[model samples]
Target: MRRTDLSSGARTQPPSVDRAGSGKAGPALILGAALLGLGLGAYAIERIIPRRPMLRGRVIYRDGDYEIRDYPAFHALEMSLYGGREDALQRAFERVSGADRDGERPAALLDPVMQSRRSNAADGDDTGFTHGRWSVRVPLSAARAADCGFESVDPRLRVISVPAQRVAVLRFTSTEDVAFGINRVMLEDFVEDEGLEAEGPVFYAYYGLSRALPFGRQHEVLLPVSP
Candidate 1:
């Protein structure tokens, strides 16, 4: 018979003690509750605030991803930025925000924010490298446009009128970061069918940008025109 020694060096786990379960139970519930509270708080805030009315133009004609419309003219404080897409937008935001003159508040300009590239010179570098000539146009109400003056010393940043004109509007749902590989065939077909001419650079408008999910975000590509 072996005698049971109380002062044995080896340790033994207690029977059915459930140490693992008991140890985890407290922290798991705490973490879960914390996460749940945060989610609820965010949802509440999202519901409480009113969303902005995204940019839109009257749809005179409509087809899938293509249409022709007469966009109303409006004034905007605009600036030309150079570099990658994100870089350009950041610079524009800073310049516009720094305006100490009218202490202007921007109407978020437009959705997806307008981005355009300048034409390379005929004799200029045909090299693979090309810099972006991105422009940001923040449209202003006629009353506000008249009242507000861009006093920024930056010559490139100035307020101007976007003359009311027609455009070939192409809409799609996409994240703003996607490369704008426009469906050239569809657009060209639209132009031919409508007997319209391409006049100026394309304007990209955005909607539903405030939503958290990137999927289903609305984007519109506006090609300027003479007709």
Candidate 2:
């Protein structure tokens, strides 16, 4: 099983011994151990630092179905990939996550970007995917954006600017592990009831990675609102 750090969106899978007599752990194992070390360190520092979401925006209004949030403009590095959501996440993880281990270079981490995604096939499309139209985005701080040296990862990843905007957000948990995509009715309802206009590319922010079991696993969808 893969575990994502709650404080930082670092992916950690359990360490496993190499079966080929290499006497070395795999990248996943090394990454896991490194993150475990950092997680412990962060736990100690959490006592002195604010422990809320590093990317959390201000909640301005709420009527039950959804809440209006005021989000300041933030820079993000987005990568569109031709794969399932998990594949995109893993690709994004291997590329952008802040981890140092076993001769592998550590990614820069001033403030770790929140792991967020937007699937293009949200309209009940049973097909997995046809083209490279889906995208995965990691919201980055200005510092991280400036220090980004991710030249060795996939070539398709690129940075994009996200303007300051208000968003209507909905929180929910699911029981299915592999299912994804924004709930159309909830988004539409929020848009209609709140009288808020929305733009394109809705976002999904998983509390942990979306691969976790559905029950009590928290995640949210953010619809960009017209300012």
Candidate 3:
């Protein structure tokens, strides 16, 4: 009989392919490449850029990376933050720069941002979140005539007058986010070896963006000492 066979006449269809996974993967790869390029470019810019002149201080003693410097009295904008170091730094920057409030005068940005760790014993609970203070020197013009009362847009920030003093400093360069611990230890060892006593908590001074390349960034662990 000439009757069409239903099975033979049935249309064959190709298997359906799921492209959702591959579609996402393509964009992710592109984004990753873009970010990598951006990071490299930033590192390059930092390397070639001329740094703002650091606040001048006389070197009292020098021993390789370790030194004793006599710094003059200066006014600084200081703030405390309790969380990630990056977040803390950003918030502190905004506060000091007057970007957080309207009609607030921005403080002059300066080299060598300073930082100090806050003791967790006072808080009574170690949540692993970072607790620290960040300080940046502002232009002398920003200081009030009466006192070191530098106006800040954020109440958390205040202007403090630092007295002229001699500090034991251990300088190093690194790419890590926080190099205070190891550098502090080294400074302490150097101070002890030199028969010097630490008069205050160890704080850090950074001369470059936190994200700058290791070679382009400079860090110092500073311990106030009896002069």
Candidate 4:
């Protein structure tokens, strides 16, 4: 009589079993802590980087020229597009800083100069890129009276003495969420692309209005020119 070999037919042993009961809790906790620490460290590094607000000298174009205006300039521009009577710009500033105090949002201190609103331009232009948001073009120099343009201005131009200064500028579209980390990366790229140095508080020279420019359609980046 052939005896049935039940042992042979029994299920093959699994390759491995977690009998230690050590469970994933310890390792998972450790991993999660590590990740948390890593993220915090990265954020700390980002904040620790030195960022100062430098003055961007005179800015001019074929259309017109602009001198350095005070923070009031920014407030004015913001108010124009936002509303009247109330200080909505100040409110926006508070929101941006996650604070209810002044002197927050360092980038706001840079001031707005030439506000040029561009219609949607396709391809590289990417105008009206970030809704109808404005794109700024500020000039930089040793002094306001100093030469700010590419070179000598044409006969049709006039050089006016404005508040001259140095600055680290950036051009970015508006966002419901501002990601400093990504901004830092893009800032590095922009500096390299422009052959300029990164001396940044990250200023935006808003050209037009925000509602006009759509996503990836607006054109703005930090300008890291020589001091």
What's the lDDT for all of these models?
0.62, 0.58, 0.65, 0.36
Q: lDDT: which candidate is best?
A: 3
Each candidate structure's TM-score, on Cα atoms with residue i matched to residue i, is 0.63, 0.58, 0.64, 0.26
- Which residue pairs clash in candidate 1? 111-206
Question: What lDDT tens digits, residue by residue, belong to model 4 across residues 146-216?
Answer: 42332232232233333223433344455422442355456556556646564433443433222222223
TM-score of predicted structure 3: 0.64
lDDT of 2: 0.58
Ranking by TM-score: 3, 1, 2, 4
* TM-score of candidate 1 versus the correct structure, residues matched by position: 0.63
Q: Write the per-residue lDDT of candidate 3 for residues 1-227, one digit (tens) a residue.
A: 13344787765555456564775898899999999998889777776765654667799789889899998887666777665555666666656555323344433456677766664423643432255443443323333323434453466667677788889998887635546567777888988999988888777777765344444677788899988
In candidate 3, which residue ranges exceed 4 Å CA deviation? 1-50, 98-107, 121-152, 210-215
Reference-based TM-score, model 4? 0.26
**Local distance difference test, candidate 3:** 0.65
The regions of model 1 sitting more than 4 angstroms off are: 1-49, 97-112, 121-130, 153-155, 176-179, 183-185, 208-216
Looking at model 4, residue 199 earns an lDDT score of 44
Error of 3 at 160 (Å): 0.7
